[model samples]
Target: MKNLLIIILAALLYTIATGNTAAQEMGDKEKMKIFTNWIGRWEGEGSMQMGPGEPRKSKVDERVEAKLDGMVLLVEGVGKAQDASKQEIVVHHALAVLSYDKNTEQYKFRSYLKDGRSTDAWIKPTGENTFQWGFDIPGRGKTRYSIVLDPVKKTWDETGEFSQDGNTWMKFFSMHLTKTE
Candidate 1:
């Protein structure tokens, strides 16, 4: 009876240890939950500097969704603004995917633009409700975008900054959105 009790205790201890290890091994799905508040439809206005000229204003729409069994977030955005003749035209259109890489233990952001410009960048979670993503341009400069979602107010604010010397930054873009759904 004493030997049997010892074996049972050892088995229980081993099971508990393995269970804790498994629980602590976070997967991609768990990491993706950081974007939960961003999973919705949003509409608002945005502006971006096109040149040394003034920034153009436009109405923007964003749809964020969870795909691949919640392992990735698919983000689609469209911006419409009036042309010189006051005709509504597409100012910007983009599709992006956000995913957490288990191997790298980091988030990846890939964006596709209407102008055939695409970028594969890194995304860092700044807080429970914020994410910043960007990439470095070899000869030009680096551009970074930061997005903050206010769950209480159901608002999303994003800003874009560019740096040429890795120190001084210029704010070139901004978007203010309200959750529509």
Candidate 2:
């Protein structure tokens, strides 16, 4: 009876000591750590031009979260602005997902607009906390967005640019956001 109890206690201790080692070994992707500072709720202001129209001012709200056991970063943003009739309306709404592909060793970005448009684009870290992501349209040319994250200041500045020849670029969108949570 004593020997059996000792064996049982030893097995229990071993199990406790090695708890979830497989999961720990296959932990979150190290590359995704670059986006840690961006995981939060943010609010700010922004301006955008539609077609050839003037820029419209809007209030921006963004929420970024890590999901799927840290396999992906999900981002959602909404912009509210006054229309020409002076009525507040949803000017922009977008949701995006960022993930790292271990096999290809590349980052994949998928962004969707409120109007049922979506684009799968390439995304990569440009600097310590800066990243660029974008896709090319069939005929409209190429559109790219760059985001600079200042973790110290908890500020996020993003810009959108378009290029026709993939050389000459024009800026058409921008936003400045501060982390609120």
Candidate 3:
């Protein structure tokens, strides 16, 4: 009777350990799929509000790819628009990495710009097809960026907004992207 009890306990422990390992692997793969959907070259048009004047129209291109065995997504974006004076074309470049955090159970974003500016934001899933990344801007309130993916249309729509009171949002930029490959 004692031998049988020991064998049963050992079997239960093995099952529990293997089950948790399998679940964790499956969870990671599922999370990876969410980011892999954005992997491809995208071209689009966008507009940005740089100053007090009107928003300037711009040409935008972005590329996203899975890295680190699908553990992270690397994104690169370029925007070309006329300057405030409309005298020359202004180019803006940015790079970003999106990764899932197991401890936080959420995704994190780290972005770097050509002007040597960088931002770290937390990502939230707002809807079935939409995700929002946001950060507090100290005295400026908050800034949020949202992206909606349309799988059927193979398009990505993104918007940037700022809120002084955290209740009223003012849009400052918008982009519409179509997958190129």
- Tens digits of lDDT, candidate 2, 84-178: 79889998999999988767778899999999999999998898999998899998899999999999999999999999888998998999999
For residues 94-161, write the lDDT of model 3, one tens digit per residue: 99999888778878899999999898988877777788998888777999999999878999999999
Root-mean-square deviation of each candidate, in angstroms?
4.5, 5.0, 3.8
TM-score of 2: 0.83
lDDT of 1 at 147: 94
Worst 10 residues of 2 by lDDT: 20-29
Per-prediction TM-score to the true structure, in the order listed:
0.84, 0.83, 0.81
- Alpha carbon lDDT of residue 74, candidate 3? 93
- What's the lDDT of the predicted structure labeled candidate 2? 0.90
lDDT of each: 0.91, 0.90, 0.87
Backbone clashes in candidate 2 total 0
Q: In model 3, state the lDDT of residue 97.
A: 94
Look at candidate 1 and give me any clashing residue pairs. Answer: none
Ranking by TM-score: 1, 2, 3
Please state the error at residue 34 of candidate 1 in Å.
0.6
What is residue 142's positional error in candidate 3, in angstroms? Answer: 0.7
